[model samples]
Target chain A: MRRNLAIVPAFNEADSIAPTVAAIYQWAPDFDVLVVDDGSTDATAHRASKAGATVLRMPFNLGIGGAMQGGYIYALEHDYEVAVQVDGDGQHDPRHIYELLDHLREDPELNMVTGSRFLASSGQGFQSSAARRAGIRIFSSLVSLITGQRVTDPTSGFRMTNRRGIELFARDYPHDYPEVEAILLIHAHRLRSCEIPVLMQPRLTGASAISSTQSVYYMVKVLLAVFVGLFRRRPIEAGDRPAMAVEHAL
Target chain B: MTKITLQRGLAIAVTLGLLLLVFELVRRKRLSERYAILWLVAATTLFVLAVWKGLLTSLSHDVGISYPPSALFAVAIGLIAMILLHFSLAVSRLSDQNKVLAQRLGLLAQRLEKAEERSADARAAPVPGKRSALPDHSEAEAEAPVPAQELSTRR
Candidate 1:
């Protein structure tokens, strides 16, 4: 069974949720859509559900990281074979879902694959603003040094993960700047991750919550998380190890 | 009555006083014990140089420095600067760790809320294994699609 799910974490994305979900359906009908609504005050959950997506409303706002963590938890609990992350801000073009899905279809060892805005082989992937580009470069360098592998788009929210990656993240995903630190987390757990070029649209909703100060907060916290991971006791190792079913405990 | 004996004793006193300051800091947790070694060295060096100017001047002359006090003060400042930088790094680490802990707390609270909801739903109704005890609270409202039925010929 190709039980693939696209996990879209949305907060106050009322305007974009319907169109984004519709685009997902048009682009990849086979992939089930799960919208992890982070306790949005707007009609994000309703709109997403109306547009034909599974809605998991967090009790309250848990931010982007918490919302995605909930999606991973759902995937783990329901035994989803594959789970991919798509932004709910109407940024990730549904057209690129095929390109990402193709990578998974090709290799089973590829546990996690990210749609990189900077990895365009044809130089036709989405273009970002200058500040975002700089932030991505800085965070990517940090991930590269820590993971001992090059990562072009460290903060790209467009990512796909197999069962193994989903379970790993469900157990221990970063609490903040998750899309960036997730690369490090996946690496620390010794999982294979790949990045491919994908198309993205500009955000189609309200004002962005990511300010300059927030970017600094994001970078510093992620770097600190990497530093702290070095001292964590009994780190996880990737293999056919026993899965950590932590829903009840959590 | 008190020649170089009191001067030598005063020099030892200042050095020991600086060591005591480092010890006090270590005891109360203002300074990490590992980095306290550097603090101890810095404090002792500054105190010794302050008390024994003649010895430092002679050594400075040997090392071919014109202003011995300025050189010694610069070294002390450099040591202080390095220590401050290290302390700042520790502060940065602690700040994010605090945020991570706060995030974890929020997650735990969410779990607690879900648990309460499940318990409430279980108490409200009892049935065989069909659905979950947790309440299915739809997060989004209004904009979510209504049922596709109910004589919707009018737009």
Candidate 2:
């Protein structure tokens, strides 16, 4: 039996976490939901627990990267076959989780599958502000250039990773602007990645952590981080080097 | 004594004051011995250079500087800059350590919560024939750990 763990990284989404947890339970009961409350000042942990989700309360806010890394570590420790990350603001619909899992299940070659909001055929929902979209576009282009793979949504947090992907991220994940760099990291580790079309809903409550003004700064920093990843050696084991390197070498 | 000697005397006095301060800080445990060593070396070097006036004159002549005191000022500035740079590097290391500590604390807190929950569940469950529902509560506690972030060093 393939065990799936749903990892929700929430920061002060008390208003929206309940319904999100409920949606996950209703839509994907097969997957065990774990909400990592990232030192929320609100009732996020309480509401998530009441909604029947396992709540892991962080002592303080480690940002989104920290929370997701914690989830990955939990998944790795619990021997979960796969772990899917869902945002707590209810932007990522739980229904699409099955779509991502479907790809990972059907193809043994794939290590990770991400949900993209900007697919042309997919209906438009909330695409965020123009500045943020522009930033995402730049990141997508950069990731595509490096990985030799077209990625429409490099910044999407709604993604699923198999055991190998979970283990890699559990050991080493970017502390800031992880989504885009994560794609590059997966490539560096010789992991296969794919993207699926999924519509993003409007945020349920609370403003985005990155404001409009900070979008430019976010883009520059993420680009710098990704650039640094270009020079980074693959995180593969020594004995299996030639095979993995040949497969992923650019 | 000449005007240069007066200035030299003041510089020596200031160096002595700073050396005393570093010693006092080390004695009070306000500054760790590791860091105090740097400050001590800096102060002692400055004191020696200030007292050795002939060395400064000869060094200034060799360096093509018209004024000997200018060379003294230059050496003092250069030494202070190097010390400041070393302090910056130390601070950077401390900051990285602080980040790791914060991350570990958060992960440990999560584990503690899980252990408490397991024990609570074990206590609340209906036992039959002295067999608890959670048979491996201690085992769970022992294995409870969640890593916080990418612990791997960046290239």
Name the best candidate (by lDDT).
Answer: 2
Cα lDDT listed for each candidate: 0.75, 0.81
* lDDT, residue A226, candidate 1: 70
- Lowest lDDT sum, 10 consecutive residues, model 2 chain A, at A241-250
Interface RMSD of 1: 12.7
Q: Give the native contact fraction of candidate 2.
A: 0.24
**How much is A238 displaced in model 2, in angstroms?**
17
For model 2, what TM-score does chain A reach?
Answer: 0.91
**TM per candidate:** 0.60, 0.80
Could you give the CAPRI-style class of model 2? incorrect
Off by over 4 Å in 1: A121-125, A231-250, B1-155
**DockQ measured for candidate 2:** 0.19
Measured by C-alpha RMSD in angstroms, how accurate is candidate 2? Answer: 7.7
Q: For all candidates, state DockQ relative to the true structure.
A: 0.03, 0.19
Using DockQ as the measure, which candidate wins? 2
